[model samples]
Target: MASRWMWASQTIILLGAVFVLAGCEEQTNSAQETESAAVVSTPSVLASAGPVKTAEPQTPSMEQLVERYKGLELIDAHNHDASDSRYQSQLGLWKQTGLGRTVLFGDVSEPSAVGTDAVAWEAYLKYPDRVIPYFSGFDLHDPGCLQVIRGNLEKGYFGLGEIAVASTNSPVVSKVAWKANDPMDGYLPQIYDLIAEYNAPILIHLDPVGGEPLAKLEQALEEHPDTIFIFGHINAYNSPQETERLMAKHPNLYGDFFAGFTLYNPDGGGKAEPFLPVLKKYADRFMLSTDSGYGITEVRAIEAMYRVLDQLGDPVVQKNIAHDNLMKLLQAQPATQTQLKELRKQGAGGAGTEAAPQKLSKLEAGRLLAQAPKG
Candidate 1:
């Protein structure tokens, strides 16, 4: 009985040992599974905490952007300010359109009412900073005209006007009664001298009558290498050969695109096709201007001009024409400094002066018509 009891006890002990080993194996397997799960979760946590990579934002189109210039410092190389009301309206337009600086040329075509230094001075007083008055020596035959030009230069007028030496048969010049022998003929040399002395630029009305404009321009350039001459209203309708010839020969010569739409249209009188190739070739020497009158709105004119250029496939070039080129030119001049001083003094007297006028009297209109050379 003692031997049988001992055997049962040993069997019971073996079973207990087996149960202990199974529990140990199960615990080991559970720990391994938990460790594996932790390892997998660690990668996901690292990924969530890491720095994110993102793409750069795209640039906006030129049309989408507003004029980004900070101040009202635009140089309108060509503009007219004849009457007080017209001047105010145009001034408001400039302010509204974000054009801060303007160069006002008195009505050149006026017959009996030539723009005198006093008239220009009054206009300058109207919008000191905004308007830079340009003196026109239309009566170059008048010795007083030289005195006026000199006086205005000392007082800080921007430059001279749409002056022209009439070609033999330019209808435009002839209609305006602008004789080739008038003051401009004798005045040309003197004006060139004054420009060199003041380091100023002059705007010349150059429309080839009998294909001699290139020769005339060449001669002018040779005589006054230092004088900067801007050719007003480049032949928008002329043959491409003419444009190429003029641009290639004269480095000192520059051109403004205004009233070219009429000439550029094959069907007659509307928007011109994009002259991008020509524009690109002479990008540095060319500027965009609106010879728009007080009657026409500047916004509409600017929009139309931009639309034609936009088709050219380069927004940068358009931007340069719209503002950059003018800005660069204005910045280069010291006259801006004198103008600013006068503007500040004027502004101190009151809230600020209003814009100058751009109305044309009947006499002025007749003069402009008369000045149109016969071609």
Candidate 2:
């Protein structure tokens, strides 16, 4: 009986050991399967994925900028296309770029080229609404220049300009040297007096760097407060503080803020930010321009002008600087009819002369000139 009981116990114990070993083997196989699955899945997922991406900021486009600025009713207060060949193209540019008006003048750099005044007249005649014509052809030194100016003003020229009185540094700009012994020297007072009588603006390019030029400018401003002097490029190198002081001192002394000179001049060595305070402070006393001289394209220069509007940021101020300020001067009293009749009788028909100068259209002349090789 004892032997039978012991055999039963041994069989039960062997059965229990077999069950435990089978369970261990199944767990080990499950773990191996899991390990194999991870090894295959990890690389497959990584291989399917590409380089990680990150979000980046964007800048406003030129088109977007144009759209924003198009509503400002901009006036180009100082612009020159001395060669009449580009009048049509200029009109188109002004239209496309949203320029409401332009103060147009001829090149005064060369003696012979001064007849470009005819070009200015032609443009004014063709698009009088768009152009505010200014006579700049006569020599400033000529004592007879006052009469010539009177003759043109009598014939209905808007103002005088781009009269480079102190341009001496730049070789390209100083092609024909023009310096004032001082701003008030020579026949300037007479010219100023005539301009005052006509109640028109005279755009002067006086580089008042030294004490004398500025002092003389102040003297002129004090002497003829009625003569509206639109200082071109705001005397290019003058500081904002100086500009503010001058503006405060002389209400008749306005500024032509040449955007290209401020923003694109390689030698300017400054940014637009510095001038903002003075610009905003004297918003009504300032007007924006695209001098169009700095080897910059018209479109680019116009863009710079718009940029000044954006920087100014106040709609009313922008409107004043862009259009109304200059318009006020433009809409002011012009030469009297009495003055006109006498001047006309003196053969001072000016732009209204019988034989208007001949001119080639841009498509005909400009393209060929552009295609000609550079010197």
Candidate 3:
């Protein structure tokens, strides 16, 4: 009996030891499995995270950009026909580039004033809704040129210029430069007053040379508070600080940022970023233009203008710069019969009627005649 009891106790002890070992091994396996799961889950959690950051930002598609600007009418406030042959070609380009309207004018640098004037007029007449023609036939040096300007205004012409009032440095377009005769100069003051009476805007290209030219510009703006003076190209070379100062001081003063020249000029190309603050600050006082200078192709000019507009960022500011500000200037009623009659009585130099070019294609004559005042 003693021997049987001893054997049974030994067997029980052995069995208990084996069970304890198996439980320890199972616990160890469970811990290892848990740690392995945690390691795998770390990367899985990261993989579920949305969109990895890219080194460069994605550019919006042209369709997306067009959608952004859908409600706004894009106007090119500074455009020209330097050569008499450029009007039709310009219109076609303007259409392709999505220009709603253009502030059209002839080039004073071009030798044939009449041909330039006629071409611009023909363009305006052909596409009355699209072309806002400004008279640029007169020489800035000749005070007598105002007479022709006044006569044109009387004969249903819009306003004056792209007038190279003080372009000492421009090799391409500023062939004829006007000197600023002190703060208030010769015919300009009169021209300003005359245009103001007619509720017209005058686009002037006064290269902000030294202190003197800018001073003259400020003085002119100060002297005629009612007159709208659009300083072409934000004066190209003027610093943003100076541009802001000028804009802040004068309500009558406005600027057109010449995108093409700024982008393409190797010697003085400027970035849109620097001027963005001032542009946003004086949003209503600035506009976008394709001055079409420096041999920049039409496609290039249009793209540069849009690039500037895109950098502007704010849709409201873009709209204002693109078209609203210029449209406000253009909204003034056409010279009333009374205004035209008064101009005639003044007997401003050119003929009672602006003389159309003797050689006109049937299409050209029809367009001009269609726009003529109905007697």
Which candidate achieves the best TM-score against the true structure? 2
**In candidate 1, how many Å is residue 374 off?**
47
Minimum summed lDDT over a 10-residue window in model 1 is located at: 1-10
- Count the clashes in each prediction: 36, 0, 0
**Candidate 2 TM-score over all chains jointly:** 0.71
Residue runs of model 1 more than 4 Å from their true location after superposition: 1-75, 83-85, 109-120, 142-144, 167-173, 177-184, 259-274, 293-299, 312-315, 335-375
For residues 38-77, write the lDDT of model 3, one tens digit per residue. Answer: 3333221111111112213564433344445645767888
The C-alpha TM-scores of every prediction are: 0.61, 0.71, 0.71
Off by over 4 Å in 2: 1-59, 172-179, 338-375
User: Roughly what TM-score does model 1 have, to 2 decimal places?
Assistant: 0.61
How far out, in Å, is residue 279 in model 1? 1.2
Pick out the ten consecutive residues of candidate 3 with the lowest summed lDDT: 1-10
**Local distance difference test, each candidate:** 0.48, 0.62, 0.60
How far is 246's C-alpha from truth in model 1 (Å)? 1.4
Ranking by TM-score: 2, 3, 1
Which wins on lDDT, candidate 1 or candidate 3?
Answer: 3
Look at candidate 2 and tell me the lDDT of residue 358: 25
lDDT of 1 by residue, 1-375 (tens): 010000011110101111111111222343234333433332111112111112124322222222433232434556655433245445434543445556566545223225443455555554454555665645665555577667666566657765655443444444444334432365677777776666567776654522465566678777788887777656444544566567788777777765323322332244344355666777677776555421233443343344344444465665566556655554444432333344444442122222321232212222222232334
